[model samples]
Target: MIIVALDPPQNVDVEKWIKIRYDELKEYVQGFKIGVPAIIRVGLEGLSKIFKDYSGLLIADLKLADIGDVMALTASIVGDYGFNAVIAHAFVGYSQAVDELSKTCEKKGLKLILVVSMSHRGSEEFIDKHLESFVEIAKRVGSWGLVAPATRPLIIKRVRELIGSEVKILSPGIGVQGAEPGTAICYGADYEIVGRAITHSENVKQSALKIIENQKQRVAKCRG
Candidate 1:
């Protein structure tokens, strides 16, 4: 599945732009990822309005890393905004914050996707070292999915091996971040979170279609 990360520019009409993107690519991609930039620009209430009729998966990339109480409240807010799922940080540890987020997400009918590892260079400094621990936390909390980086296919492969198939993996860092389309899926990711590539393209629908086709070819080759 290809999940478009809608990080619109602060100067444009965030809601309208999101709606346009959604309408254009909804048929091709499986879902949308709303990151902090868009949320901060339009707020959750605005998101509620924009996605009021959207039936596809809507994920709030909040990356919640606060205390248990705060995380729970945030998850509730995201749910109230009509988000289907939410992303949280797994480095926050297992028993408290992550656990509360998981429970709250479940109560609110939202899938909790934890960020086990990141896609940037700095992530290698710390997050990469604790990859196993993060995976363990996700398993213990019974998280619905995990955020792995597409930039590092080996990391996605290792994460898939550790978690097996019970939990899903969502990978970012495609396109602008340098990972080719389908690179993550070829390794192990169930979904690729693409942002600028499609959003910045002149023809949104075509870019999305091209990406989907590329992913299909890669997956077929890997299986064969």
Candidate 2:
């Protein structure tokens, strides 16, 4: 499964890239990641419109990190807004944040993917040391799965071992980061996230097709 991050486009003319991508290749990717930039730029009305048009999964990568009540409320709002999943920071409020968000999402029957490790050089130090703590929290909170950078496949495997198979892994490090989506799946990624690789490609549909093909190859290899 590929969750393409439909980040804000550079030029005003490129602003319609999310709708265009969704229109062109919704079948290739499992869902579309609607982050802060897209919501801010397109607004709720625009987002609702997009959701109506695109009949695929929607992940609101809002990275909610605040008090438990506030975080839960925000997550509930996103779920009510028709997002299939929402992103929350693991280290923000830890168990409290996860617990509240998980409860609300479960009540609404939505998935909550925790941001265990982000795809940036700046996040190395803390994630390196406190990974176990995050895993422990994940176990306690009863989340649907976790979202980590696919760049660290070994770490993802380790985290999965600690948490168990029931907790799915959503990884993002393909395309722009040069990590092959198939390799990530082979390393235990249930859902591979490819951002700029498909969304920013000269041909969005082709880029998405390549990723879906990669996913199929990986599944075949695993079966073999």
lDDT of each: 0.91, 0.78
lDDT of 2 by residue, 1-224 (tens): 78788886666643476677778877666788888977888876677777775666688888888878888888778777778888888887565667888898888878888877776776687865677787787777887778877787787777777778888888888878867767667877788888888887899898788788877897788768
Model 1, residue pairs in steric clash: none
Compared with the true structure, model 1 gives a TM-score of: 0.97
- Tens digits of lDDT, candidate 1, 97-167: 88888889888999999999999999999999999999999999899999999999999999999999989
On a 0 to 1 TM-score scale, where does candidate 2 land against the true structure? 0.92
TM-score of each: 0.97, 0.92
Q: Give the residue spans of candidate 2 off by over 4 A.
A: 13-15, 53-55
Candidate 2 collision pairs: none
User: Residue 7 in model 2: shift from native, Å?
Assistant: 0.9
